[model samples]
Target: MKATHQPPTHAPVTTADLLRMAALYLRQHGWTQGTYYATTTPTNYPTPPACAAGAIGIACAGHTVEHFTQLDPDTLADYLATLAAFVDHLDTAYPMFLIDDDGFALDEHTSPYSWNDDPARTAEQVITALEAAADESDQLHLTGGQN
Candidate 1:
């Protein structure tokens, strides 16, 4: 009798799944990122990257590190608004990034791919990506201000 070999099972995450995971991670970090985001249509002007790829990041603007300690509600709100726009801009840009740059594809036979070298990007990393996207958007320039 001949011996049979069984292939290993592999599961790759989808773009939608990654987006959902990113939203959950952001919420866990206390930035208040919403579960759903709207996409800008036509033009497709700005393309952003997926959360898994660190393309659409999070950020807090007009709020300094000291503000958090002071507990300024107004400033916090402003920061949140900026962060939302930043994320939205990212949503707009992500598709573009996927189109312009080589797409991220995982082979079922190969090992799974990691978003960041750390495998899991920290909150700081998310903020950094958001800032980078904002810069690319050219809508707002993020200066190293804290939230």
Candidate 2:
């Protein structure tokens, strides 16, 4: 007899849920994704180089399982499962930015110039990028309301 796999108790993961879960995980584990470390000293605030030359921002870090969240219930079990799968396959949940730490000050793979000038892309464009990333990874099973 074949053993049937049991479905996850947590709900599906969504874009909004992803952010929330990430924040929650960060808070719970005291894990900083270089998010707290702004780009600039005074926070360039809509200007170029939000942080220092090698500061951590939102473009150089890799995503993890804790980045995922459930829809109905805000539990982290679902997200953890996703992360587990990602690790098993040696796949990154998503490409993210982080602080290098050993460099100047929280240094990581940051853009040479400031990314402020670049106007924010439309929601559709952002969604498209996410979908593409998920497709490439082959583990991102996005639901309808996941956006």
Candidate 3:
């Protein structure tokens, strides 16, 4: 026999869904890899010890189970923008994603997941990023449409 986690009821993930799930996971259960939390999982989809990338990926693609037969990707918000505007707006929300107190955020130069997995990384930081990404997504929508 094997222990398996259940796929959440939420489906057809939206940007808001991704943002909300990631932030909430960090806030409530938290990303266990970093911080002083004692929870870890040899299996997958451990909600009590959520991971930023795992949460985001699960919401985005259901990495652990079959949550959705179709991903609509548009239920989150009601706007769109150009790439230039997006970059500009991103700085407004998450300029800190690339910078730390001593400056230079990423030391490993791996991926955002690695950044999330850093033991020095705080749950608040991941939560902020998730919230900021949602904000940036909304900001992009102000452009009317992709440009």
Residue 139 CA error for candidate 1 (Å)? Answer: 2.9
- RMSD over all Cα atoms, model 2: 13.4
Q: After superposition, which runs of candidate 3 have C-alpha atoms over 4 Å from their true positions?
A: 1-13, 34-46, 61-110, 143-147
lDDT of 1 at 27: 46
Best by TM-score: 3
Per-residue alpha-carbon lDDT of model 2 for 1-147, expressed as tens digits?
337877679974443344333333333333212333333344433222221111111222222211223122433444334333322222243323444566443423222122211244232332333334334434344445342
How does candidate 1 score on lDDT? 0.36
Candidate order by lDDT, decreasing, is 3, 1, 2
- Tell me the whole-model lDDT of each prediction, alpha carbons only: 0.36, 0.31, 0.51
Candidate 3, 62-140: lDDT as tens digits: 3433222333454212112122222343355434354568876653223444556776878787677767676766655
Per-candidate total of colliding backbone pairs: 8, 12, 2
Model 3 worst lDDT window (10 residues): 75-84
For candidate 2, what is the lDDT?
A: 0.31
